[model samples]
Target: MSDWKVTHSPSAGRRPRALSPLREHLRDTFWFAPATAMVGVFLVWAVASEIDTRIVEALQDRGDYDAVEELLKVADDARTVVTTVSSAMMTFIGVVFSISLVAVQMASGQFSPRVVRIFVRSRITKATFAVFLATFLLTLLVLTAYDSDPDPRLVTSVPLVQSLVTLVMVALSLLLFVMYVNTTLRLMRVGHVIDRIVGEAFGAVALLPVGASAEGHALGPETDWIAHEGRAGVLRDVNIARLVRVARQHDVVLRLIPRTGDFVVPGTPVLAVHGGRVPPYRALRYSVSVGVERTFHQDLGFGLRQLSDIALRALSPAVNDPTTAVQALDRIVQFLAALAPRPLDASLHRDRRGAVRLVQPVPGWAALVDLGFAEIRGCAVGHPQVTRRLLAGLDDLALLVPEERREPLLRHRALLAQAVERGVPEASDRTFALRPDRQGIG
Candidate 1:
């Protein structure tokens, strides 16, 4: 029997909505969040300055200039201070950007190039940039409210409150700068990166529903294959809810051809509608979103791919960092443990009447196991530490999963033993590599 079986049957459909393009774009872009915060900060500072200026004017009109006399005395110095700080902040922004870019470049070189996405999408980095820009904007707005010209009747009043607020903003920005540096350093750590990827993978597994069985029901004879008509990219997400609605309306069973994270070229078969009535092509096309790269939003494989990439890169001759590969394997084991008990292949979306509408493709248990460990085992040929770690990970998974799920691990273990025996000519080295130890020491 084939290790991975893809069963095609009408299933109880899930109602997951497709991700909007705007939302997905905003999540990937580094500037949107910070830019929005900057606009908000500018408006807030403008309002506060106007309010402070009005209070001072009201006091002067009421012959109560003494209330703001201290502010008027230092008006000239306050304007100079705000101007200098704003100018200095502009220079500071440039420096922060330069340092951030350098750090990203270094991370990309040290890790896989795709890992740079994690740093760019970091919330701490975006918040730090927003705070710095907000402070600069606040300073400029407050500078406009400060008046150096002395009025003969003392009619002009300085914005004491606004100036103090600008100073506070500067203090906040400095504190955030310190925190941003700490965050950047933490992100560079291999353990932290692996943990992050593992966490996301676990979360994705949890989100997937344990689907009902579709054993007896077979697909209809009449089937219409839907072909993709655009540039090639990874199938990031499918609009399950929308697809279900379309299938129900047309009374057809829509079977997704390419699973999430699969690369589809133009004119590739994407969907198979098993019914007499054909659905609108545009509706079907727009329901699925293709992107330049795979994302963790719904594609669980992408998460595994990331960890696998890190492990492979570490095992490469240029890097040859066995410890890093071991760390990635540790996380991959955790992810597999989380997915062991779940029904991964049968995704069924039903309508209000409880009829199976759409069936989407998902990776089977054996497939996931292969994806998580196969390449790493292939690369661990000469490295005892990585070989032992892979054995240990497989052993741990065997103990955690059910009997039916244990066969793959057991088979892979034999393969690992063969590879180790071949790679290490000495009997003692082979024994050590075959032993299941976290550190690969007998």
Candidate 2:
């Protein structure tokens, strides 16, 4: 039998390669989109101003009194419209985003705080803000272009195109406001949040390379260890290709000691150098990204962590909402089912000559299964809905996952049974909990 077999998964395909630190950090921020929109608005003003000037010159030269009169009338109307828009746009933007921020705060409180990143990274949120700011800036620029002298005949140019563009921008901003409200409302819903988390998790999974052996390729005994030399935080994503190139250059094998999502302190041993001189510590450190908290960029377990956190919060006695916990379990089972058949082995990055340059640790089937199910199972003690759903989830995974991979599911299944028996006093309730129902009580 082949040592490493990669079964096709629904997410099986070419995954995205590691993103540069700059791109990854920017992806998680809210400023870049609006900043870019402002710059683009400036460029648009420049072009529209030039076009308007040319159109006016042509009309004046052609001795078309009627056309010049119409253009001047449009410019007069546009000044009033642009003035109004510039005055109201900032207030509109402030109110909309303030409401959005409140909604996002409530969502973070309702679910997990980690979910705030979703809003920060939302394209709708970014695009809406960008368009709103763009409209405001564009209108202000158009207002400045209007002449101090009011006489239409004496004016060198009428900003006809700028006026039209500003009006169009106002209409677009109003349209996006409706879209932004709808998106923000959906973000508050538990089902939508859970599904989004799962979707993002799949995206992270798609970045991992496939067809690696289950038994990880062995790098010989390490000669030196590279300690982390930065502020303590979670190890996010590493530039695998860059590290591999560095290793290949120095004829060494470098093994990343901490997995993605693992926290590293300044002195934490982050890498192990084997079979050659250690590459520069700065070079190795620079190749990896450490951040304040976990992100979905390359950390598969972070998704599971978010789902579990929501479930645990739901199961808390303070919340007493088993239904929400069941919802969380629904997505958890979905993620695990999709993950069950895929390769969960250490990823080996190699050079062109087939030499292993870097070895990275990946969560195996058991670790992921546990990450998805463990804590919730512990907290699910007295909640029948959550217990039934947990049992059902494990049973489903047991059937779907291969026999060898079913051990963790079976172990959790037995643990669930014992917990149910102890937590449910009456025999009938115990039996009911033991019997699996995909929809919890249903």
| Number of the top-ranking candidate, with TM-score as the measure | 2
Q: Give lDDT tens digits, candidate 1, residues 119-187.
A: 767778888888888888888778766665666245464677777778888888888899999988888
Q: Worst lDDT window (10 residues) for model 1?
A: 1-10
Candidate 1, residue 123: the lDDT equals 78
Off by over 4 Å in 1: 1-24, 152-157, 210-222, 245-253, 281-286, 350-355
Tell me the tens digit of each residue's lDDT in model 2 across 76-163.
8879889999999999889888988899999998899999999998999999999999999998888888876655456677788999
Candidate 2 stretches with Cα past 4 Å from truth are 1-21, 63-66, 151-154, 209-216, 352-354
Error of 1 at 258 (Å): 1.2
TM-scores, each model vs. reference: 0.88, 0.92
